[model samples]
Target: MTDKASPGYADIAAHYRRLIEDGSLRPGDSLPPMSQVKEEFGVSITTVNRAYRLLKDEGVTTPRPGAGTVVSERLQVASTGAARLARIARTGEKYAPGETSVDHIAHLRSCHDPQVAEILGIEVGDEVIVRRRVFVRDGKPAVAAFSMIHSRALADVPELLQPQPFDRFWQEIYTERTGHVTTKSPERRTARLASSDELALLSVQAPENAAVPVLVLVNVFHDDQGPLEVWEDVYAPGLWQVEGEKP
Candidate 1:
């Protein structure tokens, strides 16, 4: 199977799937890293990544930095969900002169995050507007976040979910509709252990062993009328530093 002409990520994914089915690759068996896979299969790094991503999506493997990728112990692929949003930006101690804008929306298929569910005031499987993004610092993944707004609030704005994840600009749409603006003010901050879902998305290895601390930010958006929106929990640590200016 390794001796093939121009194998794609799907092909590599199949090979790994077969290994798992045949018992050659069992749960907890660490698969070769991208470097090794490239050497063995003579494929590009991107191809290897796609293969790994497929395995990851199928609940077959988990990537661990320095330790390589391994078959999931339970073989049950946990939803990555908003765990990626828990990352913090490590640079930019001071805000830039211009306003920073990120116009993107991650569609929430079915989120089970307890905090997320509570913030959006929806059931575990209820549909919501999930937005995930990584604020980069110097071109490196810095702050990773998962944000969800009540589906009811977004149902009328179907165009928000078209063409791409970040289809409609959130601030513009909100202000135009109700003369409100989304404000980000940290109400509280705390630390916690990174979950399995977070470990996978952030590509963190030995998260438990490393004792990585996550900073959770609760940002609220409001209008002159009242509280317009609330992001109950946004988590990150080691990836960002906070700064403020006096008016």
Candidate 2:
């Protein structure tokens, strides 16, 4: 730990990161129990929990129900843009012309969602360039996505507004126009009920009971400086798998 006192969750997360980097801890190693950490760090259980969640979000640790939190086999010490681009590339060029795939539609919209607004550091209803698309695999809709970019960021590149959906990778377009490639891919995966828009986009009949839990991929694209784009992707249940190398 540094001379500065570790105060809150951020401090606790940094402290753990340092331990991992200094070889004080290794991958697959279990962290001390929450009670132990609280005693050692002199922080509350909630603070310790927050720190653990932060590590989990950064892919540094995994929580086991009875065993406690363990260092993840895969530790992403730093955000590298290459990893995300490579993952996208590995998806392969499977979509062909006349494949009955979803189309990208351009629409006038405002960024109002609290989370999105916070990521963009802008107020609600701020104008943003919104691109909507659906992913159809094997003739069935498997995913739906809505990406929002600050209009001012891509204002000069009017060609980005083309009607052809998914024709141009948004990351590539931004990199070419701004000379700043997106390097950070922070993803949030969660399950939730399908909204009316999602139901319409997926072309699925709405169930009378609770909507099935779907995986939502919210990726925030950022450079070393800050965020560039925020994408909200909704995936059908059991339709996709995410695999990454452990190094």
Which is the leading candidate under lDDT?
2
Q: List, in order, the clash count of every candidate structure.
A: 16, 1
Model 2, 176-207: lDDT tens digits are 76787666554566778878778778776766
**lDDT value for candidate 1?**
0.54
Off by over 4 Å in 2: 1-100, 208-210, 238-240, 244-247
Ten-residue region with minimum lDDT total, candidate 1: 79-88
